[model samples]
Target: MHQETRLLIGQISDTHIRPKGQRYHGVADSNRMLAQAIAHLQGLDRRPDLVLLTGDLVDKGHPDEYAMARELLAELAIPCLVVPGNHDHRDAFRAAFADHAWLPAAGPLHFCVDTHPVRIVALDSTVPGAHHGAIDEAGLDWLHTTLAADRAKPTLVVLHHPPFASGIPYMDGYALRAPERLAQVIGAFDNVERVLCGHVHRLMLRRWAGTVVCSCPSTTTEIALRLQPDARPASFMAPPACMLHLWSAADGMVSHLSTIGDFEGPFDFA
Candidate 1:
């Protein structure tokens, strides 16, 4: 029998940090929001074992923006794993986060991290020079081989683009290409606990191919929720948030959203 193990993971996505002193649009400051979120993560009763930054680390993928991001992220006490989003430049991202040896020097950034309770497989869904996401044959083969390598451990797949189409029309247009292929790959593994994604800039949860797919909202601005046919493309400064994925053998993996901000708390439960 697999001994019950508990692991807590923190995920913050779409940081979209601009150069120092620059704001994301004229309003939202990615750095400030990220700092607050980090403070909140650290303040949790139990700290996470690892923090995953699911892409879009910078607004323009510029060196200066990456420098600012690196500096802000340095406050984290746990191991931080990163993947590239559509807004990211592969070379710039790799260079900026060079300490992460798991990142390939110059290719699709797909790798797996073996941690206590789950095997985290981060897939590179960003296609070069494109906004939409795709996992080519090679990426799929890599995923299959990686998952098959060890079947006992529970798995968590992370990517920038979600495989399922969200009701938000504009974002849906850029949804992951050929999702059926991803489905097939995920379906092959019964131990996969969840697929965590970011990019839509909203918090959403759905089940795709028997696995839960959850998209984390951005730490900057959020895409306006317009599910109607006539809805126009717009973004709103909705409450910035991140997710905490907790795992244990008995309860499996459960995800919770931690909205960034100071809130009144804990009076005695008596």
Candidate 2:
């Protein structure tokens, strides 16, 4: 049997879903936005082969919120992989998403998903009792050993925190601690095609460690683009979106942003 060479991955992050009928920060309706995102994905011409919920699955570490997030995500037609963020409770997340075979029964929720044309390495960067992210020694060792085992496969490293600092001051303050460690591991691996992340609540693309690191925008709120000292982070109702990563034998890997919601389109240039 011949394997499919082309692959499409849908990535949604920073959902921040609150308990039923509740809004994020008392304004953004996360549940409604997530539903719209799911509907849009369902109607896409070429549906994604798999979906990844990068992190921040809920606003608070509550059982009800995890239940709600899990319920909403269950609507997707394709397989979904998940990781926990600073705002998430690992135990609750594991319980809610136990059906995913990649998820472990305990410890850091890290695993590898092998699909045609690409392999995804989901890293757990959340630190207990802290908003900032870290990979710790054990996680780093695991990452190093994992990448070394299969050096030929095209890999996409998924994590909740942005390894590098974004220009936005307030958001940068919450960046991953000692990112150089993560950088060293990735730098050693030439097969890593991209690093996909969430938690920044905005779309960011850049070249790091000889590979591309792209952060997906939140499905709930858009973070303010304030690039200055003492700039406070704020989210607005700009637009909810997800990242589409396409990979093939010929083209390698490329990503595009799929903005969710009603819009005008199909205008021809003829």
Residues 1-270, model 1: lDDT tens digits = 866678999999999998889899878988899898899889999999889999898888899999999899889888889989999988898899788888877789999998566899999999878899999999999999999998878999899999988988989888899999999999888899999999999889998878899999999889998899778999988888899999988899899998888767767775
Model number with the top TM-score: 2
Q: Write candidate 2's Cα lDDT for 119-224 as tens digits.
A: 8899999988789999989999989988998999999999999999899999888889999999999999999999999998899988999899999999998899
Q: After superposition, how far is residue 197 of candidate 2 from its true place, in Å?
A: 0.1
Clashes of each: 0, 0
Give stretches of model 2 more than 4 Å off: 1-4
How far does residue 12 in candidate 2 sit from its true spot (Å)? 0.6
Candidate 1 error regions (>4 Å):
1-4
